[model samples]
Target: MKKTIFTIACILSLNIFNSCSEDIIDLKPPYEEIIEDAIKSEEDVNKFLMGTYLKISSTSLYGSNFFFYGDLLGDTFFRSNKNFGGYTSLIMMNYDPINTGDINFYRSAYDVIQNANFVINNELTDSQLNKQYKAEARFLRAITYFNLLNYYAASPKSGLNQDIGVPIAVYPYNPDEKIARSSISDVYKLIVEDLNYAIENAKAETTSKIYITKTAAKLMLSRVYLTRQQNGDAQLAYNLTDDIINNSPSSFKLFTSTTKDAFKNYFSSSEDIVAENQPETIWELDMNVLNNPGVNSSLSVFYSRTGSKRGLLAKQTFYDSFGTSDVRRDLFSFTSIPVEDNPKGVWMAKHERAAQPGGNYTRNNKILRFSEAYLNRVEALYQLGKNTEALTNLNEFASLRNGSAYSGGNLLNDILSERNKEFFGEGQRFLDLKRYNLPINKGTNCPGNCDVPAGSKYFVFPFSEGQLIINPLAVQHPLW
Candidate 1:
């Protein structure tokens, strides 16, 4: 299986190289033909990793949709009246499996998996650089697998480990061959296996946080375990996040200050978030003027008040949920005068680009951040029955954000609400709602289909019809 996979990977990689050289001028292809010669030195391996990283950041997947998909699916973001340009189907729960090209995240993810497999299956371990390259590939493969499962399958918490996840494609790409989807638990096991290897060995020393590291892998591990919600998984989550929190104290502090402009600075200055100056940023997808998701697909187009679409907005009730003293609420701004004879309830300005419409979208897509590690730990501790410890961590983080500390109440509800506030526009609420299998009580404010009531099929997205046609054994999601 390994030999067959490796041989096919070479072909797939050559095709990837050819597409770049022949069509895309901006991405310079690596020198003269064939696998071994092009990959003779360490420089060759670095080039492949960088190319794969760019591919993963494509707008279809992480570059844009995946982030907001989290918001649109959850209670946080929904289409405002008269604004139906972006994610209307998702917010309205109207997915069409037949509209294959636009909605599917399959190809982009599999492309990365294939590219990463090329690096992994090769005997790239003769030198230190080669081993590091292998580790980097492992990290990317793990990250892709994690997201794939999130979209295609139900969480164990929701489905008791019996849901179908996307196919395991880590071996290699073969157009003739088809691998059936694995159970959610099985896919998670592979994700953990790859991430564990990365946790122990991947340094990612030369690359910026854009590349995954021990800390990033640990954060991912913490999430996976927390979602599983088993006794052992919860403990693992606690241990993993505790190490990241305690060991890297200064390296991962939250943005806090005396003035109300505390969290504002993190988003107000585009440089702070995208340039890696903010301490909270663990791993962020780099976007710049020269290289970015084209203006039409840029993430900025959705969140900015004056963005291209600005289809979604923070609900007034959601806005009122925040305390007056909370610095986080300042991240939003409503058009009180009414753009189309109707005012929108403050689109999230958390993604301000300073020079947005004129410049290419330089808004960095944050993959993992330090603040999440705190939330992950608090959730784990709370689940472990260590309410005191969980509340302490929660209060500490809340205090830093200018919110009142918990004197003593329902920690879980408080934590959930805080997640809604802190991660607004960063995309998190959806999965939590799915994992808990709770109705998306969009309250009285939502304009359409707000109630994602119990046992909703919209919880998981449809596999594209093109995918179903190609892979005969694959099943379409029930909702579609």
Candidate 2:
């Protein structure tokens, strides 16, 4: 079965490469050539699916772009002085209305979405194969749309439904055709629907926690419901995810021995990972520095200082947020080694991997974890007025970092702070800020009045001008 699947995957990959290249260049081939040669068998279909997975390695999405844009562009982090050009301009509030970085992110997200749609719409028809592959594709599509919507459109309640989101292109593209921006509601609706289908139809045996599985679908649904303020649905989704964690064959345990072990083991190793169908992880980007050079290069960009060139560093605020007792502070941040041209300064945690004497650094980009599931359950319980249950779960996680148990305050606030500390530099701060409706500290470095009070606009990024050009129907987000 594995060999058959592998062979099919290769054929499908070749087909996708030829098809995508032809579409980009506007090659006019006969209709029969296009349809008949598209995909041949179940094996071909599997290969096309692999191609979609391959695109995640691109710099813009799961690769370096995810690390840099998600962390550097937000507060609580900054570019290292050695590697501080466009990044300083970004974090220091120097982005213009037409920033090229924003444009690159926009195009990259669309590229991933397009590949997912191709698999969903064109490949996999056998009932067994269709069920498995479709679920994976749907999960990928939903994740891509979620990222794009968060970056390029307003939050759901911003009344920007009429505003164009990134184009929802869901098929083989015809270069000559014009696409319009989809409404935020429509886009979200599609995302939810896709996730629901994936949850119901995806094969449990073929799934793993690291890859998209039924639990991942539930987790994503919870997230979407929370974003839309659908409390009941959110609670339902969270409950479902929690049940998976509590009852799954794989156990989700926090590192109770020490903070350093918690950070290092959780992020850098697979000890905490729940396999495909288990509970600890719902979905994770499959990244390894050994076979996948793209993920390796991207992470290297963040930590590399080959002379005076540094990439990004931890912010002073982030360092200050932790108390003297918090060991995560030391584990996540580091001082630079003195090299001939590179002066020493504080660098962000190279926790993902240790520097190799002459070999490349390698680590998986963990997109989700069992810890997140525990947090989700706690938050949902709190929102549902089950404060006691929420606190119980909250303290359980906190106790893992240190031997001391948590004495909780405001349930929501405790959850937020816990997330901030646990997930710092993991590309989750901005989402936390948006979800809690907290104002981002524009601070002294903001280009205009740093004092502009935060609200919905602060949470939503504006659509790129280039995207608007291609899809004129897309409208600028309000209060941009």
Candidate 3:
């Protein structure tokens, strides 16, 4: 279980892409440290693992763009005219290999994966704590890989191109080595493997939502299975969620209060929950006053009315889709301040302002939550032909949120629509659309070019030209 840590011989060369006209902004590499035998004990592994978590929370990954693109590319939000020209490529669905944000995401994700690989490959100590640290590292790597695959590779169900996926790194990064894109099937294989290992060896959910736990691993793996939809995968996903809802510890269940204040307080709470509270977040990135991603990349910056760079506004159509009785609708409110084109607009209130001087609007990035368990299970049940069970679960979840009861007709669509209402700003829609092979329809909010055809190659983002040049074996996505 021990291995020699090798020194990095060369600095990885990355093309620093920047074009203000194209709305591209440069980002720093996540890690510049040399790997050594520094990680020789459980404490060392713990420290490095924490670094990996910090890297994964970068704006290019989960903290901002990763989640924002999910809603931006989907139908939830549009680029407001009062806005400057930042992130225009994402909203317009026109990006190439040289786009800085895309490149940043690709590189940052790999950087995190490399760190996780370092932890996983080396036996820092033969202690039980070391085993848990490795498990946590594997969980981080799996989630990173899964997110990479979502953008870099076509969905397994997309039927467009499924052969090429992002490169899989299981060992410490070596700059001199050129890596090729693994097959999509192979990439998912490694993700599932890592997650399964974490589920077996990682600690259970306790008082922390910031750390990955067995419940988080199980929830993530269920999502993976739900996405793949291979033989018996729906059943597998359903079983995992069922166990979570019924058998997991009380610290990992939903916030099932039906009151408006309860729903509002849940999203706007600036602090992590203690043991006595009903758990909503299964995994979240810790964002505090001391450690905050400043305005430009902060998730709250886009949604908070006080945010100087507030450019993502809710579409009137989407805003109206909420039922009158639904407490979730209260999450959106009018902003009188005129953006570029619009005189006033509605903004999502899910991310509370950690409002600091100098526009450092910040909030914890909620990555996974318990409500998804119901959504995933409901969809899986419908997919498994258990319509009665699916409706029962769906109604239970909806009633808790004060949404009108859904009786019948087109149950799958109902499930998806419910997900849209429940997770509008949380970055779930884009992939949900892809998995279901649905078109991206912007309705009245379309900026000239509205519909991205079902199974379009645009769904599969292109590999950076720099990556293709550096790793000769690396292939650009087809039709990019």
- Top candidate by lDDT: 3
Worst 10 residues of 3 by lDDT: 14-23
Task: Return the TM-score for each candidate structure.
Answer: 0.88, 0.79, 0.89
Give the candidate order by descending TM-score: 3, 1, 2
Better of 1 and 2 by TM-score: 1
The candidate scoring highest on TM-score is 3
Better of 1 and 3 by TM-score: 3
Return the lDDT, model 1, position 12.
28
Taken over the whole model, the C-alpha lDDT of each candidate is: 0.70, 0.58, 0.76
lDDT for predicted candidate 3 compared with the true structure: 0.76
- Expressed as tens digits, the lDDT of each residue in 197-311 for candidate 2 is 8888765533334356665676677777766655376677567667766664343433344656545554544332422223334455544433244423556546544322355
Give every collision pair in model 3. Answer: 81-340, 82-339, 82-340, 82-341
lDDT of 1 by residue, 62-172 (tens): 888787788877876666665447565776677767543446578888888877876776645557657766776877887788787777776667663365777887353
Candidate 1, which ten residues in sequence have the lowest lDDT sum?
A: 5-14
Task: For residues 1-480, write the lDDT of model 3, one tens digit per residue.
Answer: 333344321112111111011111122345344455455556556656766777787778887877787888887777677744577677777778787354468778888887788778764555677778888899999989998988888888876667788887746556777888888889889989999999998888655577888999999999999887888999999999989889887777788777777787677755445221347778887665534677666877777766667767777777777788889988887756454544345788887576445445555678888999889999899889999989998988898888978876889778988998999889988989988888888765556448888878778788777878888788888868
